[model samples]
Target: MIEVPSRVSVRDLAKVFQDGEARVEAFAQITLEARPGEFLCLVGPSGCGKTTLLRCLAGIETPSAGAIEHRLEPGAPGAEQAMVFQQHGLFPWLTVEANLHFVLRESPVPRQEHDAIVQRLLERVGLARFRRFYPYQLSGGMNQRVALVRAFCVQPQVLLMDEPFVFLDYQNRIVLQDLLLELWQEQRQTILFVTHNINEAIALGDRVLVMPGTAGPFAREISCPFGRPRDVVQLRTNPDYQRIVVEVTQLLRQEQEHSLREGRIG
Candidate 1:
């Protein structure tokens, strides 16, 4: 696979939807950047356009305004930018192993190397024994992990994930979070992960970008003071972790309160 620059820049970005005669602004003037191999997490209230923003970054949705620039090498798709939605998006008919292989179909990974790649990923997720299980046969967390494996198999330079584990139960979610950090440490891809869970955001991101509830710029940018090689279970017990959570929760509340005063949101 070809290596490409992982830096992503979004400038004066905005997304608006036309609801008949009404123009609904999904978000506006959103500017941010994620450096190479950086894990940037986005947190926002419902309808704040976090998912929409990710879709735009993935080239799945066109923005209503502004520009998103990726400094990829010319003639390369930047290790082929990959996006994972909240939905597993896996083929139900395909077994877990088959699903991972499916994504490699268009990837630069040689067909002969596909099996080894899949083997490594499945083992990493501790799902090697269940490789033949279909999506319907696996739990939500397992299926989501498979989805993660699928994305990583492509060896994307930039990974945009929208609430990939939001639907899972707590235990599964933490395990996956740790697994994700491990995978990311190995691949060092530029990751932009969206989550409503602030603790999850704080646990995983290098910096947390809050989209907020109002019609203005982002609420705030909070840096995670924790060092890398983070353990989800251990992170929660730290005093700094509690402080950061309070700080983020307050910011989101401030945004929502401001929106309420302005009558922008309920």
Candidate 2:
């Protein structure tokens, strides 16, 4: 039988980057927790350290201060976390199947299990027919789908996504959003998604954290109690969804104004 894993705790996290003579504080004292099977969305302006924070969580970048602790089960997969970035990050030379298999090959599982995992993920992402196609042969949205499949094939415990759907057109975004939701439900992975789109955040997240301005940490956290299997059409018509969107937009506007004033003062 399979056992459950613990949650992720991020406490007093801070990151600073030096650009020549200037010291830029990207984030400071960010405290948040992501429970198992939770969908958390981080929304902010263009340079509000959303991606920086994601990098910290992924262990790709060490924080300047504080801690990001992953409480996983003993002998588990070392806090399996996979990231899907704005760029598809696919191998142009390799076919879709090869790209997915590349990620699976790094796992400790036996070689015989690789084929099953790759095949299942390809079918789940609607890429079975295009498995032999290279990155250049697919559309932008389809390439992003391949990236998604690659990320999921590892069976990560925590999934980190940074603007994964920003490049797609409105129609494709909606379709992919639905497909992503279905995949998330099936996998039950703890997901932390960063996006600039307010509507997209509300549509995909169980909780939304808003970060304002180009500096510092998140300004506010909003809990979305909306039920699962959310229909985009129904949510657009829902009063609660509209209210939260308006509120988040207002908060973002306030942050922008604050940043402008500070810039002018300096």
Candidate 3:
């Protein structure tokens, strides 16, 4: 079996904004990598630049300093990376098939294969019969499923997701999480996911990074060694899973306190 190339690398990454005379550091000295075909979850407090870091990885924002490198495997099928946003960015007017086709049209795949690829993904997600339905016609979870499939439809080498299911209730969130895992298990694309929920992070990530706050980059990297095809509901009750979640949550709390103290001193 051939090894997949490392999909992304960030070195001494920093993003700063100028607010009048004051400098705002979103995040700095953030060094990390998205291992080939692995899921990496990022967790942090609000204003800690999780989304900013993700946007930088997506090439949607220029870093004020440092570098982000993306290496594609030889003969890779599509773009180097694709991002799924928190808002479930499906076009309101486009049908499900049309939404997926919109992405494929931008990929390197042959135009004639677009329809077949779109149909296959929709079928896999159990949305085959809703191909002609618009975004407004579907429930929030269904729309999110479409957004996810659309991202995968591009067959990207890396997937960057920023809390794509954060707004959904527990049932919907877990369902989409399972759907995401299923798609990922089949394709094994490199993924960098950002979330506030520690349980969600542990449930889906191979490694979870905890960001301290705006004052620091990533403060800790916790490894989750659970076996494949994880059942979130069952994992919730598993002692090992609970232990990891508590460890991660404690780190987050400590970071928040540290940040508050530093703020007062500054």
Candidate 4:
């Protein structure tokens, strides 16, 4: 049986990078939590430490201060996490099927089931036909499809995504957004997605956390009023969606002004 989703908690989180008396504080004095199966989106201007925070949650980077906890449902199996980056970090030498297998080498999934897991997820994403194809042989959008399936194949407890579709054309972005939501609806993993697109954040998230312009505590936490399963294309027509867009935009505008006053951004 699949382990239930985990709840994430962070207390007084901070990250600082130092090099020979040169000190850079990525973010500091932060506190947040993600409820089980909740889709959380992080939004901010560039260099607000969004990615740094995500790395901490994924256990890739250690925080300079504070605590992070991934508390799974009682009696559930152990937790697993996966990440999808803006770049499709697939090996040119490996075909799509092989790339998925490579990730499972370090994953908890059984070796005997690896082939089936890869095949099922690829088929779910309509990428089964391209399984033997190399990443270089695929379009940027198709490679991203492979990347999405690869991340989901492990059925991670926490899925960290960093602007995975930012570079795609509008049409493909929308299509992939639908695909991602469809997969998440079934997989129900706790997601922490980082994106600059306000619409994307609101459309995909249950709650959106807006960060300050510079490295500091988070700015605002606004709950998305939309009900799921959401349709991204039709979401714009909803009055509340438009209202939330304006609301988040206003909050971001305020954050930019604050950054300007603090000399954090020019």
List RMSD in Å for every model shown: 3.3, 3.2, 2.4, 3.1
lDDT of 2: 0.84
- Model 4 clash pairs? none
The residue-by-residue lDDT of candidate 2 on 227-249, one tens digit each, is: 98888657988889999999999
**Residue 99: error of model 4 in Å?**
0.4
Each model's lDDT comes to 0.87, 0.84, 0.87, 0.88
Runs of candidate 2 exceeding 4 Å displacement: 1-6, 75-79, 214-217, 264-266
Where model 4 places Cα greater than 4 Å from the true spot, the runs are: 1-6, 73-79
Compared with the true structure, what per-residue lDDT tens digits does model 1 show for residues 1-266? 97644489999899998988988788999999888888999998777789889999988889989999987645543255788889899999899998888789877767888899899999999999999999999989989999999998888888999999989999999888988999999988889999989999999999999996865578899999899899878999999999999999998887767666756544
Looking at model 3, which ten-residue stretch has the lowest summed lDDT?
A: 257-266
The RMSD (Cα, Å) of candidate 3 is 2.4
**Model 4: per-residue Cα lDDT over 132-221, one tens digit each:** 999989999999999998888877888999999998999999989999999999989899999989999999999999998766678889
Comparing 2 and 3 by TM-score, which wins? 3
Each prediction's TM-score versus the true structure: 0.93, 0.92, 0.94, 0.93
TM-score top scorer: 3
